[model samples]
Target: MNAPLTATGVRFADTALAQFLCTNRYTSLDELRQTATAAPRRFWHEVVTALGIQWAKPWTEILDLADGPMWPRWFVGARIDLYDNLVGRVAREDPNRPALRWEADDGATRTHTYAELDQEARRLAAGLAGLGVQAGDRVALYLPMCPEAVVTMLATTRLGAIVVSLFSGYGPDSVASRLQDAGVSLLICADSFQRRGKSVPMLDDARAAVARCPTVRNLLVVARGESPAATPPDGSHWHTVDYQQLIAHVPVTQGPAIHPADTPLMLIYTSGTTGKPKGVLHTHTGFPIKAAQDQLMAFDLKPRDTLMWVTDMGWMMGPWLVFGGLLRGATLVLFEGTPDHPGPDRLWDLVRRHDVTHLGLSPTLVRLLMAAGPAALPDALPDTLRVFGSTGEPWNDGPWHWLYDTVGQGRRPIINYSGGTEIGGGILACFPGLPQKPCAFAGPIPGIAADVTTADGQPANGEVGELVIRAPWPGMAAGFWQDDARYIDSYWSRLPGVWVHGDWAQVDGDGHWYIHGRSDDTLKIAGKRVGPAEYESALVGHPLVTEAVAVGVPDPVKGETAVCFVTVADARRLAARPWPEWERELAEHVGTQLGKPLRPARVHLTRSLPKTRNGKILRRLVRSAYLGQAAGDTTSLESPDALDHIRQCRPAGA
Candidate 1:
C-alpha cells in the first residue's frame, strides 16, 4: 500500500472546486485516491459531461479499439468541429467572456473575449481560403505566442487543414525542413519579437525559408515589433496584416466540421535517430481528452484556477498548456519573452500579479532560478495555490523541496510529470491528493498500464529500467505524419505492441514512481548503470550549487566515465574558493545523497547550462561533445553558446 496522504498542506478559497468538495466532499487524501481508483471511467465520463462537449452528430461509440492495434476511435461519430467546440459554443453563451489574455515581457497585456477570438478565427480562415488553401493542406505557423497564433490554429483546424506550429526562434533551415515535409500552402509569421533585449527579425528567416519551400505560395505577415528594414521582394508577394486587417475582411461563418476520431488535427514534428524530423499526428478526441484529463488530475485543475506554463509554440507544452487550461475552463497566462531575461523575478512577478493557482515549469529552469536565489521569487501568492507541475527533464530534491517550501508552503504538491509530444499528455503524473514525496512521482495514472521493466522486459523494484505503457490509450498519436513505416519502427519495433517510450524509470516497494533520466543518457560506468539524474540530484543538495549535468564520456578503462558540468551560485567565487577547502565537504554531500560508486569522476564549473526553449538541458549536446560526435539538433537550444563552452573545456584529470 502507498503511504497515507494527509490533507494538511494547502487550502482553497471559496472557489470552483470548493463547491465540488462540498457537494462530493473528500475529507482525506485517501478519499480522493479512492474516488479515482474506484470509478475511473465514471470520472472521465463525468469530465466529458461537465465540459459539455457539443455533439452535432451524436457519437455512436464514445471509445472503440476492439478491432486491433493501429486503429482507435474516440467519440466515434461526434461531428462537432474542435474549433467550434472551443470558440463557438463559448461565444454563444457569452460573447464578451474573455477567451485569451496575452501579456508580453514588456508588461503590455491584451484581453480578447470569446466573440473576438471567434471573429478573428473566421477572418483568418477566410483569408486562408482566399489564399487558395484547401482542406488537408498544411499551413505552417511561425509566429510567437499571440492571439493571432491561437486564432490561426483554430481557423486552420476548422477548415480541416493540418496546422504545423513552428517555433518562432527557429532559423531558416529548421523552418524549411518542416515546411518541405508538410508541403505547406501558406506561411504565417510575425515581423519580429523582442528576445534577450533585442528585436529579432522573424520575417527575414520566414522569407528565407519560404524561398526554399516550393509549395508555399502565400505569406500572411502580422506586423509586430519593429518594421523590418527590408520587406520580402515583390515577386515573393506578401499579404500584410495587423491585428485588425486579417479579421476585418472575412465574415464569420462556421466552417465544415470533420469527424473521424482518427482525423489528424495537428502534425508536431519531433527529432528522430536519422536526424530527420518525424511528424507526430494528433487527433481531436485523443489529444483533447488527454490534455484535459492530465491537467485535471496532475494539477488539480478547476474552473476558477489560473495557470501559467512557460513554453513556445514549437514545443509540445505549448499545445498542452492551451488545451489543458481551456478544457478545464481555467485561465491561462502567456509571456512572450525570456523567463529570466533582464531580471530573475520576471516569472514570479507574473505569478503574483495573475494570482496564478498552478505554475508549471521544468527542472533546468528551476536550477537557473535557484542560481538567482529565492530573492528572485515573489514572497506571496494566492492562498488558493495548490499544485506545481514540472517536466522536460529530471528534477533534484532540492528544487522539489524549494518548490514546496517557498511557493507551496510545504503543503502543495510538486507533480513530476513525464511524457512526450506523441503521447499528447503525461503518461506518469502525481496527483494533488497523493502523498508529497520529494523527487518522486505518485504513480502511473489509473487507466494507464505503466511499468518500469528491465532490458529483458521483466519488472523491477528500486532498479532503473525502461518506462513502458503496456496498453493502448485514447491519446496515443496516430502515427508519424506521412511516415507510417518510421512511426511503426520508432515506437512499436522495440517491444512488439507495447509503447516503449525512451525514458528510464524506477518504482519503490510502495509503488511510487521515479524517472531516472532519458534511456539514451543512461551511463554504463565500470559495468554498472547509473542515471545522470541521480548525480545531478545529489549535486543540487549542495548549498553553493545551483544546477549540474552528468554526462558519460568514453574512457579507456571504464568504457564510459561520468563527467559532471556544474553551474553554481558563485561560479567564479566557487571556482576560486580553493577545492582543498571545500572539495571534501562537497564530496561528502554527494556521498550522502547518492552512493559513493555513483560519484562523478570530475566536476567542471561553468557559468550557465544549455537549455531548450521549453527549459530542458541540452544533455545530448553535452554527451555528443564529450564523445566527439556531432551536436545533432541545436535548433531547440536556448543558449547555443553553452555547447561551445563545454567543447572548449579540458578533459578530466588533464
Candidate 2:
C-alpha cells in the first residue's frame, strides 16, 4: 500500500471522496484505484450513475477498445445530452437554485438560477438552429467569462453542435487559424469587457478574424453595455448578429437533442512545443463525467458549494467548471476581472462577497499576491470558504506554502490538480480526505491508472520518470480533430499503448506525487537531466523573486545549461543593487538548493514572464525567444509582448 506523506490530517472527515469510495465498498483510495481499474466497465457505469448523469437509453457496453487505446470510445450505445443532464435535470429538480453568479471588474454582479439558465440555453439553441447551424457543425466561442459564454456553450452543445472555445485574448491571426481549421460556421464574441477598469474591444479582433475566415457565416456579438468597436468592412460576407436579438427572435419549441454518449460535444485546441496546434475532441459522457468526478474527489464539491476557478473559456477548466459545477448542481462564481485590478485584494474581496466555498488559482497568481503581502488581503477568509483549487502549473514550495498559510489559513488543502485539454480533468490530484502536503498530489484521484516509467519503459519506483497512464479512462480525448495521425504521435506512439503525458513526474519515498516540469523542457547538462521547475523553484524561493521561468541554452562543454528569467517583487530594492552582484547571489542560491552541477548559468531580471491564458509558463517560447530561434505555435500565449522582454535579456558576448 502507498503510504501517506503525512498523517491523515484530513480537514473533512466525511469527505465526498471518502464517502463515495466507502459506499462503493472500497476501503481506501488505493483500493479504489486497484479494484475499479480491474473492472473498468463496471466502474464507469457505477461512477456515471452515481454522478447523476442520466442517459436516454442504456449502454450495451461501457467502452470499446477495439480501435486501440488512443481512440477508445465510451458509452457505446447510450444516448445523452450534456445540456439536459447539466441544466434541464437540475432546473426541474430545483429551479430556484443558483446556477451561476458573475462579477465584473467594476463591482457589477449578476446571478442566474438553474431554471433561468436552462431557458436561456434553449432559447440560444433555437437561435443557432434558426441561423442555420446544424448538428455536428462547429460554433466558435470567443467571449469573456460572462453569463453568455456559459449559455452559448450549453446552447451550442444542446443542438449537438460542437462548441469551440477561443482564448479571449487571442489576436486576429490566432483566432482565424482555429476558426478556419475547425470549419466554424458561427462565432460568438463580446463587443468589449472591462479589465482593470479599462474596456477591451474583443469585437474588433473577432471582426478582423472572421473577415479572414470565409467559412464563418455570422459573427454573434454579446453587447457588454459597450458599443461595437468598429464598423464591418464593405466586402465582409459574415453578418453581425446582436446576441440578444438572436435569442429574442427565436422561441424554443423543443429541448436538447439526444446524442450518442460518444458524440463530440466540444473541441479544445492544445498548442505543443512544435507543429500545428491539435484539436482535442471530447464526448458528452467523457469530459463531464471526469470533470464532475474529479471535482467531487479533489475539492469535495457539493450542491451547496460555490466554485470559482480563474480561467478563460479557451482553457479546459472553463468548460470543466460549467459542466462539473452544474452537473453536480453547484453554484459558480464567474469573476471577469484581473486579480489585482482595483487593488491586490480584488480576488479575496470577490471570494468574501460571493461566499465562494471553493476557489481555484494558479501558482503564478499566488506569487503575484505574495508581493502585496497578507496585509493586502482580508484578515481571514470568508466563513463559506472550504476548498482551494490550484492548477495551470506546478507549484514551488514557497508560493504553495504561502497560499496554504495565508489564503487557505492552514485549514484548506490546496488541491494541486494536473491534467490538460486532452485528459479532460485530472490525472493526479490532492484529495481532501488524504494527508496534506505543501506541493504534492495525493495520487491519481480515481479512474486514472497513473504510473511512472523509466527511460527504458520499466516501472519507476521513487524515481523521476515519464508520467504515463496504464489504462484508458472514459475522459480520454476521442482523437485530434481531422488529424488522427498527429494525435497518435503526440501521446500513444511514444510508448505504444501507454499514454505518455508530457510532464516528468516522481513518486517520493512517502508516496507523494510531484510534477517537475514538461518532459520537453527538461535540460540534460553533461548528461544529467533536470526539469526547469527545479531551477525556477530555487529562484522563486527567494522572497524578492515574484516569478521565474527557466529554459535550456546550448553550452560548449555541458551540452545544455539553464537560463532563468525572473520578475522582482520589489523594483526599488532590486534597482539598489548591481546586476552582476545580484546574478551571482541568485546563481549561488540555486546551487545551494540543487547542486553546483545543476545551477543556472545565468539569471536575468525581467518585468514579466510569458504565460498562457490559464497562467502556465511558456518555457518553450521563452527558450526560443531568448535563443533568437523560430518560436513554434504561440497561439495559446496570453501575452506575446512578454517575449520581447526575454529577447532583450540576452547578454552580449554570451
Candidate 3:
C-alpha cells in the first residue's frame, strides 16, 4: 500500500467534526465510522440532539429493522415536521439572524432574516390553505432560485403538503410529464427569469404545461424581469392568482402541523437508466437529518458561515441547500442565473462581494472558468473562504489541482462530495480535518455502510468494482413513489439484499476511495473492463485538449472499441496543422498513458459535447448521436445544439 498523498497539506483544529470527536471521545476517523455504522440508533440519537432538532414527541425506538435493511424505518412513534426543525425553532431563538441571501443576474440582492422568512412562510402557508391545498396534496414549484422559492417550500411542508420541486429551466413537455405523474393540484412559478442577461419566459411554459395537466387547479405567478402583466386565462377552467395578492390578506403567524416522523415530505424525481424519471419520496425525518449531518460532519458548517452552491432549484442541491443550511443555522447564498454570465469572473466576483465561506461548484464549471486564463481569476483568494466543495461528476487532475492550488490558494480543502438524489446527502465525502488527495475521498461517510465489491459480490480493496451500500439509512427514499417494484429492481435486484449504486469505485491501499465513473458506461475491449473516465482523463491530460468524452462503439474483433470526442483549447491552431498527424499523435498519447489495447479506435474532434444544466457530460447522448439513433429524453440537457454539432462533425463514415 502506497502512502496517501497529502496534496493540500491543510487541516482545521476548530472544525465541527473536531468538536464532535472531542466531545464524544472518539480518537480517530475509523473509530467514528465503525461506531456509527455498527450502532445506527445511538448515532442518530446523538446527531439529532447535537443538531438541536426540535421534535413534537420523542421516539420510543430509534430504528425498526424488522422489515430488513432495504426498508428500515427510523424514529418510530415520533411526531415531527420539517418546518419545525428548519424554521420554527431557529426563528424563535434568533429572529434577527439572516436565514437566506439572494442575488439576481443583474446584481440585485435581497436579504431575509429568520423572523422575516418565518413570517413570509406562515402567511404563504395560510394563503395556500385558503386555496384548498390540504395535507397530502401535491404542490409543484417551478420558480427560479429566489426567496419566494424558499418560502413556498417551507410553507408547503408546514401545511403537511408534499412539495414537487421542478426545475425552472424545464420545457413545457418536461414540466407536464412530472406534474401529471405527481397529480399536482397547484403550481407556483415566476413569470420570467434572467439568464445570460436575457429574460427567459417561465410562465408561458407553465401555461403550456398546465394545459396538459388537468389536475392543476390554480396557477400562482411571481412577477420578475420584463414579463408582460399576467392576465387570467379568459376561457380556461383554472384561475391565475398573483403571488403577492394571495399572501396579502393572510396572517403572519401560523403553527406548523406535527405529523409522524415518516410522513411524506417531498418527491424528488431523478432519471433512470431507461430514461424514465422516478419520483423519490422523502419523509420528515429522512432527507433533512441526512443533509444536516453531512453539513455538520463533512463540510463542518458553522452558524457564521455563508455557503453557496451554483445550482438550480430543480436539482437535488436546491432543496438540500435550503434544509441543510437553515437547519444548521448557516446563512444560505442563492444566485438566480448562470455562474459565468456577463463575464467569466462573475462567480469569483460574487464570492468576494458576499464574503462566501464555502463555495461549491462542478468540475465542468471549473474547466470553463479555467479556459478564461489567469487574468479572469481574482487577484487573491477571498479571505473569508474556508472550504471549496464539488460534486455532480468525477473530476480530472487538471481541474482538481487548478481548484486546489489557484482558487483555494493551497490553504483550503476541496470537500469532494458524491451521492445521488436517492441517497439524500453524500455517500462519500472528504472530511474537513482529514488530509486530502487530488480528487480522492477520505472514506465513506460516517453513517454509510459503503464498500467496493467485485463481480462475485465480495469486498474488494485496491481494485475497481461496483459501489454498494450494505445497510439502510434514514435517507433512502420510501420506495420510488407508486412504484415499489421498480425501486427494488433498480437497486436491490442486482444483488439480493444490497443497494447496488451503478458507479465504478475503488479503494486505494491507504483506504481513500475514488469513483472511476458510471458502471453502465464501462467498456469491454479484448475481454478487459475499463471506465471511460480513465481514457478521458488521459486524453484531457494532453496540453491541447480542453475536454473529452470516450464512448464504446461496436468492433468486429475486440467486441467493442473506444471512440473519443474531444474539444481543444485552440480550434483554429489545430485546424491549421496536419489532420492525420494530429489524430495519430493523440491516439498514441492515449495508448502510452493507458495500454496499447485500450487505445482509441479513432479520435473525433468536435466543437462541443452535450451536457446537462448542471454541467454533467452526456456520454450516452454522444454515443446515441454518433450511431444515428434517437437520443432518449434530452429534457435535462442544457445545450441540445451540442448534439447537433457532434452529429455534424461525425467521422466520414461513422
Candidate 4:
C-alpha cells in the first residue's frame, strides 16, 4: 500500500470548504457528506446560500425528483444566468482584475479584465441579437482556444441561446453532423489557428461544413492574427460577418436575458471512443454550479490563484476549466500551442510567467514530457505552483511518482481527479487538505454518493467493480440532447436506481478509491477479467517504452489475449537489435510483474497510437485498426494517420 502524502504547511482552516462546513454546523467533510447524501435538498439549499450563488431570484425548491432519479431538476423555479455570475459579478467586484490570460503558439499574448470581457460579451450579444438570434436558439462555436472563443460563448449565453462548442481539430464532416443534429442557426469560427508551426484553415473547414448544414444561415468568422483575411464564399445563402467588427459595434445588451435555472445553456458532445459522440445537454445552473463547487471544495481554489489545464475546447475539461475557474474569480489561462512545440520549456515558461497556482495535465502528457524532455525540464516546478491537477485518464505509478518526485520535489501533491462529461466535474477527487496516495482519489467529492458494485449489481467493498452513483448531482447531463431514451439506457438502465459510470473502480481497505480503466476496454483472458491499465502500467514501466495501449483480441484457446502496442522513447533501442527479442523480453517482464496469468499475447512496437486532442488513448480505434476493422468516428483523433500507424505495425511472430 502507498502512504498518503503529508500536507506540510497547508491549513484546512484557510480554505473556502472550511467556511462552508462551519456555516452548515458541520465539523468535517465526512459529516457533511453523510448529511448531504441523506438529505440532498437541505444540503443544496445550504450550500447555495453559503456560497452566495448569484441568483437573480431565490429558488422555491432545491431539488424536484418527481421526474425520477435519472432526471432530477435542481433549483426549481429560480432565475439565474451564467453571464451574470461568471463575468458580470466579478467585473462589478473588481473590474480591473484579470479574468482571462491568453497566449498563442507564436508568442502572441492578451489579457482581458473582468470589465473588458463583460463589455465584449455584451457587444457580441447585441450583434448576434440584431442578426435575429433569439432566446433558446442553438449557436455552434467551432473555434480554437482564442479570445473570441471565450467572448462568443459568453455572448451567446448572455442572449439565452444554447451554445454548442465543437473541438477546433474537427473536420467538415464532424462539424456538419453536429450542426444538423443540433439544428444550429448560427456558426462562429476562426479564419485560422496555428498548430505545430502550420496554419490550420478553420474558415475553410467551417465554410465546407456550413455548405453541408442547411440549418445554418449565418457564418461569424474571427480573422485570427495577420493571416490574410478570408472572404465569404460568393452566392452563399447564409450571411457572413466579421467577429471583431461585431465587437466594435455599440454595446446593446443591458443585462442577461431572464431565464429559469433549468433552462438549457450548452450542448457538449462526448469524445466518441465507443461510437458516435453523444450530445450532453447542460442547464445554466446545473453544470456551472457543480463545476465551481467541485473545484472549490476539493482543491480549495482561491480567486487569487490562476488555473490552467492543457486541453482543447472539444473535450469536457475545456469548458470545465472556463466555468469552474471564472466562477471562482480565478485567472483562467488558455494556450493554443502544442506542449513540445517551439521548445519543451513552453509549459514551464507559461507557469512562471503567469504565476500559475493550479496546473492540470493528463498522465499521458506527463509520460510524454518525461520521455521528450528529460534534459529540458526544470529540476523543480515553478515556486508559484501550489497543486498539480490531473484528469482525462488513469495514472500508472511510474509516471505519477516521477511527476511527484522530480517536478513537485515531494512537497506538492498530484490531486488525481476522475470524472467525465456526463458527471459535470468529478465523481472522485483528491483534496489538498488531506493525505493522498500516488493515484488514489481522496474519495467521492462530498455529496456525490459514489459507490462500487459488481457486474451482477452486488456490492463490491474491497475489489474492483463498476463505478456508480446512488443519487443524482447537479452536474450530471440533464439528458442526452434529443435522445432521452438513449440517456436512460446509457446510465440508468444498467442498474436499478443507480447511474453506472462505465469505468472499473476499486476501493481499498483504507477507503482510498482508484480507477482501473474503462470497463468496455477490460480484457478477459482465460476467463480472468483484468483492466487494461494493469498491463499498461507494467508495459510503461520498461525503460525504453514511453507510452503503451493494451487491448483484448480473440484467441481460440484462451477466452481473449491481450495485444499491447508501445511507443519507444529511444530510437537507438530499435536500431540496436531485432525488435522481436526485446518484445518477448518486455512481454515476459509484464508476466513477471503481473503474473503469467495476465501476460500479454504479443507486444507490438508502433510509431504512435491514436489519441484524442486531450491526449487520451482511444483504445477502441487502436483495437479496430489492428484487426483491420472499420475505425468508427475518426474525426476526434488528433491525427487521422495514427490509425494507419497501428495498421502498419507488423511485429514478428504475431
Clashing pairs in 3: none
- How much does each candidate deviate from the true structure in C-alpha RMSD? 3.5, 2.0, 1.6, 1.7
Q: Which 10-residue window of candidate 3 scores lowest in summed lDDT?
A: 1-10
- lDDT tens digits by residue: candidate 2, 399-495: 8877776666677778889988899999999877568667788888678889999966799888789999989998889889999888888888778
lDDT of 3 by residue, 531-583 (tens): 99888889888887888999998998998999998888677778678877888
Q: TM-scores for all candidates?
A: 0.91, 0.97, 0.97, 0.97
Per-residue lDDT of model 4, residues 148-206, tens digit only: 88888788778889999899999999999899889999999988888878887888889
Residues forming the 10-long window of minimal summed lDDT in candidate 2: 1-10
Question: What C-alpha lDDT, on a 0 to 100 scale, does residue 91 get in candidate 3?
Answer: 87
Worst 10 residues of 4 by lDDT: 6-15
Q: Pairing residues by index, what is the TM-score of model 4?
A: 0.97
TM-score of 2: 0.97
